[model samples]
Target: MARLYHAPLSPFCRKVRLALAEKRIEVQLIEERYWEASPDFLRRNPAAKVPVLQLDGRTMAESSAICEYLDETRADPPLMPKDPTQRLEVRRLVGWFDDKFHSEVTSKLLYERVNKKVTGQGYPDSGNVKAGSKAIKYHLDYMHWLLDHRRWLAGDVMTLADFAAAAHLSSLDYTSDVDWNRSAVVKDWYAKIKSRPAFRSILADQVPGFRPPPHYTDLDF
Candidate 1:
C-alpha cells in the first residue's frame, strides 16, 4: 500500500487524494503538519508541502505530477482525456483552479479563516476575507458560463479538471464560504461531483477545532 502525507483541507492534497481514490488505489493517510518542517517530512519533500506521496518505492511531490503519474500507471477509469487538445484543456483548467483560483480565492479566504488559526498565524484578515468573498462570485459566474455549454469544466467528460476544481471548492465549502445559491449550474455540477464515491473521504474529513457546516456532507446539498 502507498502512504500519503497530507493535510485534509489542503486543496493540493485533496486533488491528489481524489485522483488516487478515483483510480481505486489504497493508501495510508498520514497527516503531516508541513508548516513545522520536521526532518522526516522535509526529506520526503524538501519544499515542505503537504501531500507527499510515497508509492512504488519512491516519494513524489506536486499534486499534478502525482495525479498524472497515477493516471498513467492505473489506466483504468482514466482521469485525463486521451486527445491532446482535450488533455490540454483539462490541464489548463487544473492550473486555473490550483494557481489562479488558489491565489485569488483560497489564499484570501481559507488562509485567513482557517489556515491562519490552525497554523497559529493570527486572526482572519477581514480585508483579505472580503476580497475572497467578492472574487468567488466572479469565479462562480465563470463556472456557470462554462457549464452552460459543456458538461464539465474542461469538456464533456469528467476529467482531472473537475477534481481540481472540486478540491478547491470543497475546502471553501467546509468553512461555509461558498454560496451554492449563486449559480444553479455550478451548484448542479458540484452536486454531481460531490456525490461520487471518490469524494467520500473528502466529505468525511474533520479538521480540528473547526466544524463543517451541516450541508458539507449532504449528497443532495
Candidate 2:
C-alpha cells in the first residue's frame, strides 16, 4: 500500500488522491500540516507541500508528477490519453486549473476562507474573497464554453484534466463558494464526475471546523 501525506481540502492533494483512488490503489492517508513545516515533513518534501506520497519504494512530491506516475505505473483504467496531442491537451488543462485557476480562485477564496482558520493565519481577507467570488464567474463561463463543445474538459473521454478541474471545483464547493447555477452545462458535468465511485472518499471527508453544505454530498447535486 502507498502512504500519502496530504491536507484534505488542498486541491493539489485532492487531485492526487482522486488519481490514486481511480486507479484502485489502496493508500494510507496521513494529514500533514505543511504550514507548520516540521523537520520531518520538510525531509519528506523540501518544499513543505501537503502532498508528499510514498509509493513503490520511492517518495514523490508535486501533485501532477505523482498523479502521472500513478497513471503510468497502473495503466488499468487510463487517466491520460494514449495520443500525444490529446495528452498535451490534458496536461495543458491540468496546468490551467492548478496554476491559473488556483491563483485566481482557489488561493483567493479557499485559502482565505478555510486555510487561514485551519492554519491560524488570521481572518479572511475580504478583498481577496471578493475577488475570488468575482473571478469564479469567468472560470465557470470558460468551463461552460468547454463543456458545450467537448464531452469533457479536454476531450470526449474523462482524463486527468477533468480530475484537475474537479479537484479545484470540489474544494471550492466544500466551502459553498461555487455557484452551481452559473452554468447548467458546468453543473451537469460536475454532477456526472461527482457521481463516480472514486469521489466517495472525498465526499466523506469531514473538516473539524467546517461542515459541508447538504448538497456537497448529494450525488445529484
Candidate 3:
C-alpha cells in the first residue's frame, strides 16, 4: 500500500487524496507537521512539504506532479482529458486553482484562520481576512461563470481541474470562509462534488481546535 504524509486541510494534499481515492487506490494517510521540519521528514522531501507520497519504492514531492503520476499510472476514471486542447484547459484550470486561487483565496482565508493557529503563527491578520473574504466572492462568481457554460470546470467530464477547485474550496469550507450563497451554479457544482464518496473523509475531518460547520457533512446541504 502507498503511504501519504499530508496536512488534512491542505488543498494540495487533498487534491492528491481525491485522485487516489477516485482511482480506488488505497493509501495510508499520515498527518505530518511539516512546519516543524523533523529530520526524518526532511530526509523524505528536502522541500519540506506535506503530500510526500511513498509509492512503488519511491518518495514523491509536489502535489500536481504526484496527481499526474497517479492519473497516468491508473487509467480507470481518468482525471485528465485525452484530447490535447481539452487537456490544456484541464491543466490551465488546475493551475488556476492550485496557484492563482490559492494565492488569492486559500492562503488568505484558511491559512490565516486555521494554519496560523495550527502552526503557532500568531493571530489572523484582519486586513488579510477582509481581503480574503472579498476575494472569495469574485472567485465564486468566476466559478459560476464557468459552470454556466460547461458541465464541469474544464469540460463536460470531470477532471483534475474540478478536484483542484474543490480541494481549495473544501479547505475554505472547513473554516466556514466560503459563502455558498454567492453563486447558485457554483454551489450546485460543489454539491455534486461534495456528494462523491471520495469526499467523505474530507467532510469528516476534525482539527483539534477548529470545528466544521454543522452542514459540512450533510449530503443534502
Candidate 4:
C-alpha cells in the first residue's frame, strides 16, 4: 500500500489522489498541515508542500511527477495518452491547470475563501477574490473551446489532463467558487468527471469549518 501525505482541498494533492484512486492503487491518506512547516514534513519535502508520497519504498514529492510515476508504473486504466502529440497536449493542459489556473484562480479564490480561515490567516482578501472570480470566466471559456472540439480536454479519451483540471475545479467547487453556468460544455464535462468512482473520496471529504454546497455532491448537477 502507498502512503500519501496531503492537505484537504489542495488541488495538487487531489490530483495525485485522483490518479491513485483511478488506478485502483490503495493509499493511506495522512492529512498534513504543511503551512506549519513541521521538521518531519520538511525532511520529507524541503519545500514543505502537501502530496508527499511514500510508494515503492521511496518518498516522492511534486504532484505532477507522482501522478506520472503512478501512470507509468500502473498498467490498468491508463491516465496518460501514448501518442507523443497527444501526450504533449495532455502535459500542456496539466501545466495550464496546475500553474496558470492555480496562480490565477485556485490560489486566489480557494486560498482566500478557505485556506486563510483554516490557517488563521485572517479574512479573505476582497481584491484577490474579485480577480479570481473574473479570471475563471476566461478559463471556463478556454475549457469550452477545447471541449467543443474534443471529447476531453486533450483528446478523445480521458487523460491526466482531465484529472488535473478537475482537481482545481473541484477544490473551487468545494467553496462554491466555480460558476457551472458559465459554459454548458464545461459543466457537462465536469458532471461526467465528477460522477466517476475516483471522485468518491473527494466528494466525501469534510473540512473542519467549511462546508460544500449541496450541489457539490450532486452528480446530476
TM-score of each: 0.99, 0.98, 0.98, 0.98
> In candidate 3, what are the lDDT values of residues 121-182, reduced to their tens digit?
99999999999999988889889999999999998999999999999999998888888888
Question: In every candidate, how many clashes are there?
Answer: 0, 0, 0, 0
Worst lDDT run of 10 residues, candidate 4, spans 73-82
Lowest lDDT 10-residue stretch of candidate 3: 212-221
TM-score computed on alpha carbons, candidate 3: 0.98
Q: Taking the tens digit of each residue's C-alpha lDDT, what string does model 1 give over 1-221?
A: 99999999999999999999989989999999899999988999999998899999999999999999999998899999999999999999999999999999999999998899999898998999999999999999989999999999999889999999999999999999999999999999999999989999999999989999999999988
lDDT of 4 by residue, 31-117 (tens): 999999999999999999999999999999999999899989997899988899999999999999999999999999999989999
Task: Tell me the lDDT of candidate 1.
Answer: 0.94
